[model samples]
Target chain A: MFDNIDKTDINELGEFGLIKHLTQTVELTQESSNKGIGDDAAVLDFSGYKTLISTDLLLENIHFDLRYVPLKHLGYKAVQVNLSDIYAMNGIASQITFSIGLSSKFPLEAIEEIYEGALIACKKYGVDLIGGDTSASAQGLVISVTSIGYAKEEKIAYRSGAQEGDLLCVSGDLGGAYVGLQLLEREKQIYLENPNIQPDLEGKDYIVERQLKPEARKDVIDLLAHLDITPTSMIDVSDGLASEILHICNASNVGCKLYEEKIPLDPMTYETAREFGLDPTVCALSGGEDYELLFTIPQADYDKVKGQLDISVIGYITEPAAGKEMISKSGHVHEIKAQGWNAFKNKS
Target chain B: MFDNIDKTDINELGEFGLIKHLTQTVELTQESSNKGIGDDAAVLDFSGYKTLISTDLLLENIHFDLRYVPLKHLGYKAVQVNLSDIYAMNGIASQITFSIGLSSKFPLEAIEEIYEGALIACKKYGVDLIGGDTSASAQGLVISVTSIGYAKEEKIAYRSGAQEGDLLCVSGDLGGAYVGLQLLEREKQIYLENPNIQPDLEGKDYIVERQLKPEARKDVIDLLAHLDITPTSMIDVSDGLASEILHICNASNVGCKLYEEKIPLDPMTYETAREFGLDPTVCALSGGEDYELLFTIPQADYDKVKGQLDISVIGYITEPAAGKEMISKSGHVHEIKAQGWNAFKNKS
Candidate 1:
């Protein structure tokens, strides 16, 4: 639908003019938003509930390959990543401030496309774009989003609240994003060597969408509330399942025992990993970018979430003296380790 | 002092390991911060008052030149720039989340130096470093900060509250930051041509510091509070005096008449402008990054702030029919236009 939009050079509109053009149609929908754009700062009144805040930075090449990633998906993913943090805390995402440092290479319409996707996400999630600042970059595009949320003081679930005997649960399936990335990389190489060859991604739409536009699992949070179950501790699985489990254990000063066979994985992801000559179990453990919430609940809450379509009971918390471990389907015990994505190592 | 510290490669530490090392010593002092780092999101409790939010993105090379700007000063200036917006809204900066995207070129110690400077600024401003994220970038450095503040419901200022016949006022001097930038660029070019020649910056400390370590006018906000004088409209002078005045006028649907002779300029700023063969008045009108507060008050409150040491009553708001104009020192009339920094044009 946006293919034929007029192309205007971003330079024709200065920073201020560009901001006006993008935000002129944004109508504030939140009762807490006292003021939105066109001010030194946005004013919000969250007098009844505790405020929650989170920030995430997304760089061009380090975070995603602009060569294959569409700008619209990139913008959508950026907002999703930050909102996932708020959801992981059992908070209602209310508003966000999205800032960008754009290079001159992006025309005004290109930026508008990114904004269109971001606004779509905001509308879907009922978030108000209260404030943001834009600037020029010397090189690639850079995006930083800060999400503001709220929850009752008693309803908030922190990562340091889990204890022994708590069941570990993860919302949504994992490893699909990683498998999808492999598909894209393979296609990219083929295109690089022979520009005329089309991508061989038929029937791989599930994994590809999982990689390009992962949702934040806000529905799972609401469902748990409706089911009258409160998790002891929670976090979003962004840096792979293993790394996130380690974070929860370290923060709560506890240990965990995960079952390799119980970790949720989509059938498409499993077959794709096999096709790529990779282990599906390892993909679920080490592959990142699955924005699923991982939490621990008491034994009494097991019946409340049992057989849920979106959640999986993966393991249980253990004493601190028992180091984190996992049990294989073949009845073998093994140490769990995190070999997830390390951004700095990629640069080095 | 840090020269002998361990020069650990950022790659070796990994993203999570590096964040733990850097933030191991951080302590949350704000009562509003219910939970700090080491969680999916930071929890805050802005219970009794309205919350204020603002964000800014700073990119290397586009916003600053490393040749003349120290990493420490750059970090300090980043915090200052964001806090200025809070004060402009008549609020006290309570907390900030500072995130950075770094490249492999920066070592662990270099990142530490930047954090140290940011901590110093936060300490000076009585704000807490609540949460942040670190990531790797493929290009130059990027810093994004989001500041949270609070103000009484009745005491907050907005850009759309100005009325005709209100007095226009400004805090501190203008144009020093722009001239300081010129001086630094000149010295940098000289050093590039002859590395051995030292920079000739003698007796220019005021303007140089203005550029390198500009402070947000929290004291001015406090003064206005103590004087029981709430501004009808307010904005910070990051985009020069003229642009800020225009923002107020546009938002408030009013016109303004600024007296050229009444605009404040440090004597050093005036001399430096003349030395560079530029007009001091024009510099004050179009130069940016001054980080001063421009506000308007009812004419009845004029006697209350008539002879303040740091404030100057520069003009008065006019009816929308009058249009925005500046009375030249030579008794000539000229329309005021915003020729401020255009980030996109700089790259184009």
Candidate 2:
């Protein structure tokens, strides 16, 4: 009763192909939908204001290994990660809907503890938990969250808004979250090899917390507002600094030169990178999950936000013909490439 | 380092505990959020209109076993199922955010076909597909959709609006979706036992379609508006008619008496029940996935909607003291109990 049709493997299309295929068939029915399917968030015209909507999914083994990550922090981080996208667009998150797929083996209290972490994050971030779905899973846990926020039409930021000769700025430190992950994974291996031996996590608290409990940089947006400086372009640092910089450059038809010394790196992150025998500079450039804001401001407004926020001027936007490159502390120039975490290739 | 903390499973707290834990920590920083967390959807006070947000998740094994289901139909049903909730609350869906957790085993074409099906439903319902997340899963496929809609504050309907002596009404035929599930499961088993046998499904098209491609009762909402009659309370018939009736009775603080004969049953559903040795009345009352509307209307406005829509007046609201019962065709009375599909209990 079944017709023979050749099925193509999902890996063949890659993540981009799957998204394009699924969204290509959609037609907008509402006039309020100004833009959909090709940005950090879907933009909607909410009368005088613009609304932004975005979603993210976290799978158990693939996104977070439960062996080292506690349920509560996992829950809290899930909501925070999604809100980071809204903050990336320079918007205030107003509400969120969370959905979870749980295995039947999970006890009731474990789920509550996860929510407890999520609740703490929500309270800290000033957003509301609106509505969601809960269901049973066959194997592992899955959490999906969609966040909605609003901003005035003029205050909204997009990756495509960067202009030539714009100043590049970054908030907070980089490489810490990635270094934290390394620390956790190392401790996990040590614990597995010998259960009686305790993990030696001395003086790595900052990096470890950066990985386990990253916060959305909503405060940066508030600070920009207070300083009366709106960014020409912006994006959240979730997929490594190099990849996000490339996104801004590609979207704005511009190139950038990032100074190695200007890239913010926490002291703990530097120490941990040396302990792991990895280059601290490489970790700062290509390591992911910083949850910090990467943005560009016009030359005229650079002084306005110079000291208003905890930001560092990393580079300057250039003409697209110049290409995206980074200037090292040793006076050597290297082309930037994205080697962010690819789940398909890395999944064990 | 490992901490000696007590471990608890998620099932012990149930769905409500998880929601409470997550929501209790949420802080509403935005003034636009008038209500959050305890309603069908988050109510955002956006100027003159109130925006409602809700989300639902459908997992392969938990929500639908693809062994007996088609991919395209499953995609269509997923969108319809979530929209059904928005319609039940007397709101029009404006936009949707879809997230899919797909296994690498499925071909790219198969995933595209699923989206094709979703596109069809989106057009029919006048909702825009705004944003979504695509990720690779280790096992089965999962789809989570969040819908946003709006309604005038005065026109919004809630489960608590039903008054005593109000009439209980339902739209279209019931129990067909449940019977349809049985028929499909039987055919699947037969085919699995003998691959050489050609199964026949032509005569069961109606029931099969009901099961595979159920549509949300958006027309009923429009019809009520056209007829100048508003439901006192409403909810979609997703978790079986009996279970839904109890929800209304419990929420509205009233009792109901359902007449078994008045319950609508399609001819295909009746024949399928007999073939399977199941009671037709029980199937009509306790079978789910109908996506029909179960609502209450005041007696004073009954004449306005009597023939305006495909409706059946199967019962009436009574004083809470009377309790919930069903009157059989042979003049027997039985207490109504909900035995709807419970994902938690059935997961094992």
Candidate 3:
């Protein structure tokens, strides 16, 4: 986090001036990026490569609470989530257009902090900040990011490409981001009653970071390529494991049999969910915001991903007649239901 | 505008269901579009072409007033504004990603109407609605659109390519949208005082439509292509004529002399500004949202565009030492200034 010692008024720089100032340090490193800012549109050359495009809209109060979220982390997470979509298709993100609308309450320094974080993620992920728009909002902050990437036609993965008997796999642990949110909300309430409490977040750094800075599984995509394995179907785990499984099943016209015990859960997430009197398995199945990549590989190619420390083989595709089901740890079978993140349900 | 007779609850469909229902009519018409919705990211094949990317953020109450602006028009205008950026680069927009965040007050019918308008624009513009995100907002409606297009390497125009002797030209008329906005505001004020007043918008249909629904100058781009004229520099007139001239001048490291009489203005726009006790010339100079193509071509290409009904030669690029100036109808020279749309100016 950066200090706001110099409180500069946003109006002084105006809209165009602020955009130029924020993107002054942006340098395009991608060969596909022929143009960056300072044009009607950014120019890119993706010859001989299939382009991948994804967009995400994040509104304040609905998608995030600024009280518990730092501006820098918010910016970083915004880019990561969109990049996760590209990785879900087994593509490499090369550029992004980040548009933001915020009210007058935010000072120039605050806006700069957000841009600093966004640029950091772009640099770390090897993507260029091509073009974007900035405007004053009527209320809270608003962010929309469009990520563009590329992949070979043969290497691209689609949700409907999965076939029966493919092995279901997921990268990294699940339920961490969801449990991390629960911890943050708890701390927020406690601090609201007495602000001097300093938020008792000791030894809770892992879950807290998971909630604040969830990373896209780019390393996993690289590993898959290195291992010469292409997922039959792939998607990013953004709306919980159960929801993602249903999406792949419905698209591929297949059902799945998932083992409850095989669902990977970090120790911190398990203990944290337990402390909140919530079922860990339910948290992993229903809780969301986990930016891990979920994919499937044919059984014939299972040997390539076997014993991969970062991967968990939790299920297998079945005929549509079998229906989506999960075998619980107690040897009981239950139909898998999706309680994915519903922004409209509660708001409406 | 479509009627919202049936009030369908948005929660019934949820986020995923709503997105699926809204985009069900979308069909990929572009050969570059290999895949669209129902995936993590849209797959596009812009092989052998330089891709152009642009984005815009529109906020309700800040960018538009829902009281007077219909949902359908709002949706159509949002896509049109973003497409204008691609046209400004002398490229054909092939696809767009439209993302929206709206409050629960908007019923399912209202959202459908917006999508209906968006799809109409996409079909008419020969662009595909590739992918986007729909979310619930905590406040008013928020729209973000990203347009993707392609052009050959040699055909792409940049703002910095203008030369000192280039002729500055603009397509279509200016100040119509701004004056149109003034007329709408007057009517809105009258309606607020007495709801019975049906808004005296009888002969004002021309200007009214200019504000509510401004089309991007795609025809002018096609015309230029037909005439085999490659502009040295180009930009869209979204931020007023004077502001855009300054941008071209600053980027090209040159100066310009814009003639007051050469500025194009519709008869309705001129009369409306005069009735409001505002200078018609000033309105054309500083009032933004024109969505016309502003470009500079070499002196040798003047005959190619001469006698063109829609195209107007407004000025001529000059040496940097000449300074940016505007010649009044009375033969007086004055420094050109930009009072372009500034969202941060009055708010902060």
Candidate 4:
């Protein structure tokens, strides 16, 4: 029997408040645990290696819509999403455990299809599927994946490592995933309006793929090794480029300056944004689920990756006193504010 | 884009089939993963210590009914359930990551209450709550917890270690949790049928506690260490005593003869079963969620624990040809069959 606590609404505390309250009471006893909370992953000092642990939860309806999203892609993306956190730490994922809560309404075949997707991702990333549990759910499906990775103590990256003058870089293009989502939702609406009509998804392949099957940037980590360039700080862009930049700035106690003209946006993303009557630059800055690698490298290491096709030098870290600012194409400076995906704010 | 496979129903392969299929494709590349899948936990050779990893998933409606279960108890029980797996391996849990899929209907306060339960369990068990994800769900709530633990290589226990002639021992009393569940379900039905009626639950305290808050027997692991005895094989009684015994026998390649008279059931469980017109012995053998440790120990070390108050030596391991049998009080021998909880079983 538990003593009843003060009946306070969870919405008042918010997601961040709930996390802080839960973690505030946890005391770490293991000396091997170098860092316990408040990072991409928990850092553990194992023998000869530093291990990183991270987990992510995806729920049906809220995280994915099975009506348009394939089960296989859902599974693959679940594993990839967790692996991204480990990648954010500049660590190579070694093992993963996947736990699924299945609704009784789901058929056995649907569960296997999900696993088939997860299997493909695990094989692609060279990680082992170690252990997991399966249980029936009362409602929609839930997938939670925990990935364990390891790196040399010195090679490990953290969000708080950025220093003033470090060049900020991001891998691949941005805004595609967010725009892809818009395309899918639009198609869903059209189909709902007329049952006899088949939805068209012509020529929006890149953005569509970005939304449905986002890849973790493990390649960037491998490339850094080959170029002998270790990032001063790193984080995966899951919550939009703007929000991620703000996180690094806040964590590292510094400010940043971004060049609007330098931000990477695929031509398809720009074209689609125009079609939807939205600004392409705004989508690139505030769109979420890009799954790109955002990192800060020393100025001396910039030339090593300057000519790389997938890399973009979007900004530079600045002293805290300078504040975070984005330079517009017209040469005006504007403060950057995070308007990333917040399910709470969006929910009716 | 994924090549379309005729969607198979999950019921076609069953839970075991799905697990086997998912694990079949896993390829372990890390040398540190000494063993992966097909065990209580994955074994990892992390430097000088051996690490074990296990995960469990709990879904609302299927796993618990909010009508009778409180949020804090749900949170505490979630962690306790995962820790039981580590205790099954005779290891000390060091870290845990909890991922929750929250439905839109849940207030933020409800989520916090769940975390309060988790934090209480973590502190009680001396394990750190390291990392986790909080995501919105379209349907009911889901909680997935992964526990990481450590043990000396030589001290590690596995389900495949039992030898012929070893003694099968179980900790604490059994069948109470199952009976407790029946009482709660009955109360729920009564309350649902008539909201104005105040149900009676005066003498069912033990059974109700057993059902609502099952304890992981980490103390048994400590007791074994104090007595200088290590189990040849072990597993937690989650899927009932009969099911766990079969697991030990199958994994160890041995048979067992359990004496029904030797099986320990709490007095409350016996009385409740009679009141419900159910056989007490059947409940003891097939009822689940006991969270008691079931283990096999060599004859040489039997005397070390013979005087233990809470342990019951219910059976003895034999050659595989002997088959699994239970000797009834009337001297009649019957082959033991696993009739544990099967989520896929047809229900009226």
Specify the highest-DockQ model's number: 3
Residue clash pairs of candidate 3:
none
- The C-alpha stretches of model 4 lying farther than 4 A from their native spots are A1-47, B1-47, B346-348
**Residue pairs with backbone overlap in model 2:** A8-B107, A106-B9, A106-B10, A107-B9, A107-B10, A108-B9, A108-B10, A108-B11, A108-B12, A108-B13
- Candidate 2 deviant stretches above 4 angstroms: A1-48, B1-47
Per-residue CA lDDT of model 4 for A1-348, tens digit only, reads 002222333333333343344334334444454434432123343677656677777887778888789888999999988889888888888667776766545554566567779878887888666656665566777888888777776877778889999999999999999999999999989988996878788888899999999999999999999999889989899878998898889879999999999999999999999999988888988888999999999999988998899999999999999999999999999999988876544543
In Å, residue A46's CA in model 2 sits off its true spot by 7.7
Model 2 root mean square deviation, Cα atoms: 12.6
* Cα DockQ of the candidate 2 complex: 0.15
The CAPRI classification for model 3 reads as high
Interface RMSD per candidate? 0.9, 11.9, 0.7, 12.2
Comparison by lDDT, 1 against 2, better one: 1
Residues A1-348 of candidate 3: C-alpha lDDT, one tens digit per residue:
224457788989999999999999999999999999999999999999999999999999988998889999999999999999999999999999999999887888989988988999999999999999999999889999999999999999999888999999999999999999999998899988988888878998988998999999999999999999999999999999999999999999999999999999999999989999999999999998999999999999888888799999999999999999999999899999999889998586
State residue B170's C-alpha deviation in candidate 3, in Å: 0.5
Q: In candidate 3, residue B248 scores what lDDT?
A: 92
Per-residue lDDT of model 2, residues B1-348, tens digit only: 002223343333333343343234334434454433332123243555556666788888888887767777887888999888878878777666666776656554456556767767877887766556666677788888887666666666677778988999999999899899898888888989997877678789999999999999889889888887778888888878998888888878899899999899988899889999999888877788899999999999888867754988989999989989999999899898887766665654
List of chain B TM-scores, one per candidate = 0.97, 0.86, 0.98, 0.86
Clashing residue pairs in candidate 1 are none
lDDT of 1 by residue, B254-297 (tens): 99999999999999999999999989988888998999999999
What TM-score between 0 and 1 does chain B of candidate 1 receive?
0.97
**Candidate 3 Cα outliers beyond 4 Å, as residue runs:** A1-5, B1-4
On residues A1-348, what C-alpha lDDT tens digit does candidate 1 reach at each position?
225567787888889889999988787888888888878899999998999999999999889887788878888998999999999999999999988888877778888878877888888888999888888889988989999999999889999889999999998899999999999999999999998999898999999999999899899989999998888999998989999899889889999899988999999999999999999988888998999999999988999889798889999999999989999999898888988888887677
Candidate number with greatest TM-score: 3
- Please report, in order, the local distance difference test score of every candidate based on alpha carbons: 0.91, 0.76, 0.93, 0.78
Quality of model 3 by C-alpha lDDT = 0.93
Q: Given candidate 2, what's the lDDT at residue B149?
A: 69
